[model samples]
Target: MEKIAIIGSGNVAWHLCKGLQNEHIEISGVYSKTFANSQAFAREFGLEVYQDLEMLNKAEVDLVLVAVNDDQTARLIEQIAAHHKVAYTSGSVNLKDIDHPQVGVFYPLQSFTKGKKVNLFEVPFFIEAKNMELGEQLFDLAWKLSRKVEYADSNTRSELHLAAVFANNFTNHMYSLSKELLENSKGKFEHLLPLIFNAVDKLKNSAPEDIQTGPARRNDEQIIAQHLDKLEGDKKEIYKIISSSIQKKYHEKL
Candidate 1:
């Protein structure tokens, strides 16, 4: 796309704008319900600010990229699809749910935090469009930011999103839990960083199941009982559920 307009000024929007501009693509402007947000975002990137949705609809641009919350994505698409070719950055929002002619998905499959720069080239970009022409355009747009681009339908995108929750969200929660336990026991979470890095490093080449170690992986009942004795409430239940799952996976009696 030669010129693009952006909706929402959140983390995803911020990163996309940065990536697009790095490739010398012109951003027509940005729009947000809260004008101040768009103003600030535009100021930071030297872009024009669209004060209202009407102004955005009238802008001259090749595409409108919507990068907002999943729930709000469809509503915005419904409003703007007639005015411009639109794409949203949500994996869970189904494309069929929106009855639009020129709309698509441009989901970047990676966690984003404001001010934290990540290697966009390494992140997977999942594309979904109503037709092959639009699909190719979205793929070309994504390829400007990342080498990993693939077309995925709503069902496959939803499945990938679910897997992301387990791989990133749930794993981060486990780290938070580890920090809590460490602090309660007068230990530092940093002490476990090396171990965490080591485990992640192994995943580059080794199968997780094949390389698994620890009391649960070994079916060491005595150590498992000791760990359970130290945990309480939801933590204890979580431990039990996961340990039981691991044992079952290994064909070991619980």
Candidate 2:
């Protein structure tokens, strides 16, 4: 029964608390520089929020999970590591640079939004530790919350984070753009839900490059030009770049 204390109240911290508590981990307490945030979160979790970091220092915690911003992670971890085993939830930061032997990474590889319902059991947790002992402790904790726990070094975790930005952030922005385009044309974007869902379902069975379609994949110059002509500004630029890339890829196949 290793007790855990979470620092920060951002999306990652919120979701991590949810998942960890469900797995019966004692989120013994919470800490935040913003007093209101810590108070609110503590109320929700029915745990007291320590107003002073000194108070947190006095508590017994087997692990301190820091979910602060990337720039602040190292500083927070360093401070907490003096008396506690600390892990920062950051994908891009290298653990090697942190000189503490009790410091590690406990990054949850998923996009999170505050107040959104997230199924963390399906989300991957990437764990890294300063040594084998802390590594096992972190890995075992992650495994309790998720079926997709795995070990990833700093370099690999950073690359995976980059890939996630492309796959999730950029792709979601494209969807938002599509919705705006449909609204401008007097159409509801919900009509595209079936198409979007089907495409996602198809990818579960086939690689995207193998299942490529559309005028760009067919190298239909006329249709591509028409589509480009219909778009303008950043939209047109994005369309041209993606269309050209698709055409170049499949053309090499021929």
Q: Model 1: per-residue lDDT, tens digit, 1-254? A: 99999999999999999999999999989998888999899999999999888888888999999999999999888888485899999989999998789999999999999889989999999999998888999999999999999999999999999999999999999999888888867679999999999999999999989898888888999999999999998889989999998888886544
Per-residue alpha-carbon lDDT of model 2 for 182-245, expressed as tens digits?
A: 8767678999999999998999999988888999988899999988888988899999999888
lDDT to native, each model: 0.92, 0.88
Off by over 4 Å in 1: 252-254
Clash totals for all models, in order? Answer: 0, 0
Worst ten-residue run, lDDT, model 2?
Answer: 74-83
Q: How close is candidate 2 to the true structure, as a TM-score?
A: 0.94
TM-score of each: 0.96, 0.94
